[model samples]
Target: MEQHHPSLRSEALALLRSGVTNREVAEKLGVPRGTVGWWLHEDRKARGVVVAERPHNCPRCLSLPINRPAYAYLLGLYLGDGHIVAKGKQNHLSIYCCDGWPGLIDDAEDTMRKVLTGTNTGRRAKIGCTEVKSYSKHWTCLFPQHGPGMKHQRRIELSDWQQEIADGFPWELVRGLIHSDGCRFTNWTTRMVGGKRKRYEYPRYYFTNKSDDIRKIFTDTLDRLGVEWRTLARGSDPYNISIARRPSVALMDAHIGPKY
Candidate 1:
């Protein structure tokens, strides 16, 4: 290991303690990124800093203005396929997105960051999906719907403030839900036209979830937006909401069409 000047080490530590990334500090100080990381590690070890969570700018805790639209969208995603784990010094919120749709994955991570400013995000690859995660102790504070069991097995309801945000940005909420757990596809049938068979196609949207409360929340937002939907049963259980009406599909296409 090459030795650096004492003054350079002090400057690097100062920049790092002020929230600069290891790469940024290294470039600024003309040091290797690995050396910057090693310095930070030693400094924390010597100071007994067991946890190095960055400073959190939780809107709820700081009484700061929230990006309500982003929050609403993130809330919908949470209800569809997100979870928060806050146990024994481990705290984070994770939203799973299919790997094929890189755009959705990026959107999910971006929205999480927007909702909880100053939080750090990471990605974990599953068999066929990517988990976009953000770390912060206050995730539970924002998502009271999190509980001890699966979402379907527990009651899920938004707080009054969350409700207000959802009401104000219903389309974003619907978009988020669809982006996470819903899809838009075309259905086709054959019709005789001028003695020739012609295939006719129409587009419809479906939002599926096992949690009845979550489905109701999605439908309630649709009701407010005047987008008609019907519940459908999957294997003898109601698990899908279908939006096929022409006018409603048009409305959906205008605001929250197929996931990109």
Candidate 2:
């Protein structure tokens, strides 16, 4: 015998819209209880509504609808502490690196633009080595010119600039820049490839008992540079510093110099 009929379907839909229990509606319509559930499911599917089995919100998932900033923040957290491995010898971590602020040239003019008018919503605000090269050779040619015939001078110059930039950003920033997400200032070290020696020091910056001093130092530098920055302290432990602009080797060398 055919169970489903137009009258039963209409009654089921009406009962569902009226908030009647599926079992009640099934009994009233002389159909199995699952029939009501299947109808509701099909209705939702037809309307393109995804009803998650567990109906709770994940902040990380919800953040995407708001803005890219929220999305990026969620992404950073995900990259930082989201996953784990079981019995794997190698620890895999990923970090973000912007080669250059694609559209923004790394000249005084572009810097001025950034200072005056901030970046757009989707655009990333940072000076990359690639963008730096296009505008001026100041960063690329910091050292004394050696020979008359400089065949591959720019490439060599760029490598030097890269190293300088890498060194300038407090080792913490350097670590973050190189390894986009996983690298932390505390308890993280850089070692030489295939060697036992540690190439760079961990906990690059010192934090004293005085909280104001740390805030002052960070704020003063940012104010002088006309840049925006934020620092979050992890329960009186090491703090994480995030800046609007990526550290430039040329600028760092000029500002802080070798002593810093």
Best by TM-score: 1
**How high is the lDDT of residue 49 in model 2?**
82
Candidate 2 similarity to native, TM-score: 0.21
Task: Kindly list the per-residue Cα lDDT of model 1 for residues 92-199, writing each as its tens digit.
Answer: 999999988899999999999899988889999999999999988889889988889899998888889999999899999999999988999998899999999999
Look at candidate 2 and give me any clashing residue pairs. Answer: 95-180, 95-181, 96-180, 100-128
Count of backbone clashes, every candidate in sequence = 0, 4
Model 1 lDDT at residue 161? 93
Q: Which ten contiguous residues of candidate 2 have the minimum total lDDT?
A: 131-140
Candidate 2, superposed: residue stretches over 4 Å from native: 55-260
lDDT of 2 by residue, 1-260 (tens): 34688777877988887889898988887888877888887877887988654332222233322222222222222222122121222221112234532222222223222321322112224444221111111111212221233222222221343233323433322222223222223344577777676665433222221234323434444455554556656797544554423343334333322210
- lDDT, residue 113, candidate 1: 88
Q: RMSDs, each prediction?
A: 5.5, 21.4
User: How displaced is residue 165 in candidate 2, in Å?
Assistant: 49
